[model samples]
Target: MPAPRMSTEQEIEALDEVCQRLAGFEDAISLEWLDGYLTAIVASPRRIERDEWLAKMGQGVFARAYADPADAEQAIKVIDSRFEVLANQLDPELILDDADVLRLAPLMIELSDDDKKQLVADGHIKEDELHLLEQTGEVWAIGFMDATHDFPNDWPDADLETEEGQLFDECMLRVVSLTMEPAELKEVFDELYDGEELTREELIHEALYAAQDMRLYWLDHAPKPPQRRVGELPGRNDPCPCGSGKKFKKCHGAQMQ
Candidate 1:
């Protein structure tokens, strides 16, 4: 038999009908019912954008959208517990939704390549999954899993609504995380940033390292309280690495306590 046609609109219409029926029975559905409804809708064969669907269902029901695929329930618990730590340490604005969190959970947990494969098996990321890193708030690293180049060679000129554009936006976000400023980070990326122009892994590595160094400079030198890591200590033994002639023990070190 021939394969069935995939029509997203039909699936959407069905969901709408179900929602209408539920609304008729009750003015408002509980969060549990809404979640069950969304899960059933996406678990189907229709390829839907997870974020858009969640927004439609109401932000509360879809909040768990970014849970880790390996241990979805546990991941949510851990994230909530750790969210305050992040807010207190780095920019609280770095907060993410369920879909974004899931997309990034593997990286956050520092999973090995083998573990990543297991996550795929666990449905953490789909086999056809593609991602784009935010290089800066304005520039993204767009690419696909089953394709070449991460983003379009001509980016902004490309149709922003197309799959290519969405991929580009995702990549830009990834790059933003790398640069530590989604919207304003400098674009030090070379043409090689696009896989099509150059695929050397070393080049990509060097580019990221350079971007990190820039972020470090901003964090350390900017007048704000440096976002020092927990247990991180500046060299008290050295010449106060902040370029001051005074010993670190006499300068920044004295403030350490």
Candidate 2:
């Protein structure tokens, strides 16, 4: 028998069904800007454009469609996450409905309601809403995603061979945990070494160095509250790094108090 082929029409139809379900989202994003947003996401192999670039690309009307510039930026984030989930699916037409939603669910880290009270008590972040940091992993970006999906790239595998490589892998996790504003994060990832596989031994060394430097740079610049290996941690907002599928506030973070 001949090998099977992926039907492009089916993929398009599956994405169309998802778009249909986002009626409320389109209303939130304003129907006027929705068409342009969808167009840009489906177009190219380049890194997804940041909001600054998208607004410029969309010209004046996209901003006019929203209440304010910040609202428009958030709408762009919602667009980014949804389309990225669709793009990640190779055979979305065959996907389990619940699995897709779970995969596409807003990258959320729930907060401690009590922590919100304490922050107000201590005069830290003023509002409960401020506790929600808008963070998403852009590992779903078109360039990186395409490169990994079609080619063999060793971009993010933890080496099972050596202990030090394992340590570097852990540090790598911390680097990703650091919160970068969405557009800036996408832009930074797009620039992480030309999106190419580094074959040279020296280049691999440099790649490893980049990972190390990334952790250090963010540690110094975006210092988060130190994480605990044990008891009584305080006032933290990041997702638990333990990979337990629970947000930090609901997981190990909850017990810290």
Candidate 3:
């Protein structure tokens, strides 16, 4: 038999009892299971009525408690802290693609720029694509990509501790300026010289050299151009300085010799 429909207040009180009773277990049953239970508890599914309590309270309450999940770790502590013996759970994978993003608590959320970047990188639903029964987060009844929302004005929204991936403006500008300016300046040098010097290939070689980390590392340590060898020079017929221990005439110096 269908459970008798009660007034909104009665249904909410009944929902609390249901939650408390289920919190009996040391480990959490699936939240979907809870949703299914409460869904069948108060009223018929076909009715237009919504349960004010369960809509706001279900899995969302649990997800929010462990928002930055890395911190509050143990299942025992989580359930014991808030609900006492009512409920305890761990690692709710509420964010679909990037589990780093914590769950969505509300029935709706407007996507932020960070959210869009994460959606694209993680290969979940995109903003332009369609045919959603409703856009949803892994937890709660979140709807994404909306322009305006009807929920609480001050609800906390966002994935805590998701690293800000892109560089700041000043850092980005410096990277572009340092890497590109030398290449551009080479063109100017070529024009001024009437293309007589610094061929395109030569400019590419110079640009690549300038971009090299190894070249930069040695730049300050490079020996100054020598007027002549400061140390002794091997005679043409002497053993090679290259450690082949053969005569200089027979090794690396052989071409000159």
Candidate 4:
């Protein structure tokens, strides 16, 4: 047989009991297990519905003795901390391949620009290809190529300047902008012209992690560029700085010696 539905007062009493038991255990425990255990006591097989009186007795013990309420406070904190950990583990970045994206185009076309950008930021879709999913009243279709894709022949060449191309460009820019905060993003923006081979994703992740630690603005104290040393002029018979097989006299010796 099913257990009777708990009344509001009965639920409060049950919650108090659980909270009291939780306060007693100093060690960390799985919140899922604890919730299930509490529910089981009130569930059909056990039918221990009036556990609130037990809870009140526990609370009276807790309140009358301890000089400080640190234990009670910590009990609530641990539950919240466990819940957050679980939530983070459950939600992770999604990876979409070309075919997977194409399949989603119809539903995606209806989403607004902000939502599209959010999807890209969350790793659900590629920034460059998201704008391609534009929708008419009932039709959804691919857009055009952009400078970012280097104008691949996969898409029509002339469509590069059309609404589709513009939309694609806008979404890409928004993805870049939304990937990190301003100061964090600037490191990557600077890196773009620094001639390094680092990928955009790598740079973005580093910047975001730095921002989270509140150390993003620091330059990391890179070693100063080494100074070049001036040397004495070489004689005509000396080895040449040009690294030629011939001595200086035979290799631009007149120009230096």
- Badly placed stretches (over 4 Å) of model 1 are 1-73, 77-198, 223-257
**Which is the better candidate, 1 or 3, if ranked by lDDT?**
1
TM-score to true structure, per model: 0.20, 0.21, 0.17, 0.17
How far does residue 238 in candidate 3 sit from its true spot (Å)? Answer: 99
lDDT of 2 by residue, 133-239 (tens): 33222211222223323322223454558764555454443333233454544453455535443332323234323333322333223323447687554336666
- Ten-residue segment with the worst summed lDDT in candidate 3? 139-148
14-79 per-residue lDDT for model 4 (tens digits): 444544464565222122223322221211111222333223322333344333668656444543
Model 3: per-residue Cα lDDT over 115-178, one tens digit each: 7767767878765753331222211111110100322221123223442211121222221222
Which one is best on lDDT? 2
Weakest 10 consecutive residues of candidate 2 by summed lDDT: 99-108
Please list the C-alpha lDDT of all candidates, in the order they appear. Answer: 0.34, 0.39, 0.33, 0.35
What local lDDT does model 4 show for residue 65? Answer: 33
Candidate 1: residue 237 Cα off by (Å): 54
On the 0 to 100 scale, the lDDT of residue 234 in model 1 is 68
After superposing candidate 3 on the true structure, give the runs of residues whose Cα lies further than 4 Å from its correct spot. Answer: 1-73, 84-110, 130-257
| Cα deviation of 118, candidate 1, in Å | 18
The C-alpha local distance difference test score for the whole of candidate 4 amounts to 0.35
